[model samples]
Target: MAGAQRSEGVVTVVGSIHVDFFIRVPRLPRPGETIKGHGFAIKPGGKGANQAVGCGRLGLPTFMVGRLGRDFSELLLNNFRSNRVSTDYVYVDEETNTGVAFILLSDEGENMIAFDPGADYRLAPDDVKRAESVISRSSVLLTQLEVPLETVETALSLAKEKGVTTILNPAPARELPCSLLRRADVVTPNRVEAFMLTGVEVRDVKTAVEAGRKLLSMGAGSAVITMGGEGAVVVTSEDAYFVPAVRVKPVDTTGAGDAFNAGLAFGLAQGLPLVEAARLGCVIAALKVTKFGAQEGLPWREELEEYLRKGVLELTTPTRV
Candidate 1:
C-alpha cells in the first residue's frame, strides 16, 4: 500500500444536466395506454446532477460541466451550490430550454422515463475540453451518455491522454463507439442498457458475467452491469467481481444506478481499489432506493456513513425480483 503514490478527490461531471419531475402511480400502463397517477412533483435531477449530488454528498470536491437554459439554470445552480458541488463551469443559454425529465414511478418502485435534452444538446467538445482541463487535476473524471457523443468523446480522450481514470455511465441504452469505450477506465450500465450494448439478457449471475466480459473484451477497460436488486457485476480485463445489492423496501429505483456510480467514483478517487469501490457504490445505491425522486433519494455523506457504520445490511440481488 505504501509503494505507490496516494491521491484524493474528484474533479467534475461532463454531461446532461436537467430538472426531473416524478409521478407516482399504482401501476404502469400498457403501450399506447394511458393511466392516471396518484401524485406528481418536480425534483432536481439528471444523470449529471444526480451523480454530482452523489459525489458531493460523499464529501468529494466535485464540479459539473454542463449547459442549461435561463428558465431553470438558477434552480439547478442552487441545487448544486446547496450540495457544495462547484458550478463554475455551468453555463446558461438563452435560446434553448432547460433540460427536463418526466418520470413515472410505480408503487412497486419500477420507473419509466422521458427526457428532453434541452440545452444539454448544446454542450460541445469545447465545453467538455474546458472542463477537462480542470478535471485533470483530480484523481478521476465521471462522464455519461446524456450529452452529445462528440462532447463525451472529447472529454474521455482528454482524460485518457492525461493519464486520468475515466468512468462512463452509459445510460439510455445505445451502441457506444468503440473508440469512446476504449478510452474509459470503467463503464457502468444498467441491465437493460447492457443488453442493448452486448445482446446479453442479464437476468442472472452467469448471464451477467457473460455480458460484462463481452463488454470488457469489446473495448472497455472494465465493465459494471447494475442489476437493480440483483446487485452489480464488475468485469476487469483479468478478473470478475460481483458486489451484491442491499435489501431495503423499494420506494423508487430512479437514479439508483447513478448513485452507485458516484459512490464507486468517490471510492476510487480516495485510492480504493475497483472491488471495494463497487461495494461502497452498492451501499449508496441501496440507500438511494429507500426514498423517492432522483436527487432527493441521494443521501448526504454523513447519512450514508452513519448507515454504513450500523452494518445492518443485506444483499438482495436475487435471480429475479
Candidate 2:
C-alpha cells in the first residue's frame, strides 16, 4: 500500500468502506419476489472507497480514513494498495463484520441496492480525531454520510478549522443539520438527495437550480446537483449555471456519483474555478457509466487526459441560468 504522504495537494477521504456483492438480473425483482440472476461478482466498494479510488486513479495523492471488518480487512486494504490510495488511517474492527452491499443490476444499467452497514457504523468521532492530522494537511477533504453522522461532522469541522477545501457527497439521502452543511465548501448531491435536503423537486435544470440555491441558503459555499444524463446544475451565492453530461451508452450507473465527486475534488484541489471543476466531474461521471462495476469503470488520469485530447465529445461551458 502507498504510504500516507504529507503533500500540498493531498485529498483525504473520511468515510465508509464495504465489500459489494453483485447480482446481474434482467430486471429488479418486486418486493418478496424471487428471481434467478444471470451473474454474480464480489468487489470492493463503499462511497468513501469508491471516491478515494477515483481520486487516486486521477493521479491525486489520496488517503482513506474509515473502518473495515477483520473478515475483509485484507481484501479492502489490498484494493486500496492496487488503486494507489494510502491506507494509513483505515481501521479494522474485530467484533463486527465488514460492511456489505447487495446490488441487483438490470440489463438497462439501473440498480437497486440494500446495504448492511456492519463495521461502518463503528467508525466513531474519535477515529476522525485520530486522523485529524491527515485532514488538517489535506488540500481537499472528501467525505460521505455512510459512516456515523457525528464522525462526518468531526472530520468536516477539523478540515474547516485548517482551511482545507471540503466536499461532502450526501448519499443514501437523509436530512442534515445546517451546522454540518455549513462546514462543507462544496456539496455534491444527486437529484434525489437534493430533493431530500432542500424539498425542491429537481426534475429539470430549473428545478435543480432551485434546489442548489436552497442548499446555498442552508450554508454550503456551493452546490452541485447532479441530474444524471441531463447533466448537473452548479450554484453559488453569485452564479448559477448548468453543465451538460457527455453522451454515452451507460452499462452500469453505479458509482457515477462518486466518480463525479472525485473529479470535482480533483479539479478544486488543482485550483480550477468551481464551474470548471463541475465540468470535469460531468466528464468523469459520463465516462464511468459506460462501463460495469463502480471502481472498475473509473477512468485513470491518462484516459481522462486522452479523452479530452481527442475532442470527440465537446463539454459545453456552463450555461448561465
Q: How close is candidate 2 to the true structure, as a TM-score?
A: 0.96
**Reference-based lDDT, each prediction:** 0.84, 0.91
Instruction: Please report, as a residue range, the 10-residue window in candidate 2 with the lowest summed lDDT.
Output: 1-10
List pairs with backbone clashes in candidate 1: 230-317
For model 1, residues 243-262, the per-residue Cα lDDT tens digits are: 78887798999999899999
- What does candidate 2 score in Cα RMSD to the true structure? 2.9
RMSD of each: 3.0, 2.9
List the candidate 2 regions with Cα displacement exceeding 4 Å. 1-6
- What's the true lDDT of residue 70 in model 2? 74
Worst 10 residues of 1 by lDDT: 312-321
Error of 2 at 238 (Å): 0.6
**Predicted candidate 2 versus true structure: per-residue lDDT over 1-321, tens digit per residue:** 022343566899999899999999999899999999977999999999999999999999999999999798999999999999999999999999999999999999999999999999999999989888777778899999999999999999988888888899999899999999999999999988998999999889999999999999999999999998888999999999999988889999999999999999889888888899899999999889998888998999999999999773466467999
> Model 2, residue 93: what's the lDDT?
91
Error of 1 at 62 (Å): 0.1
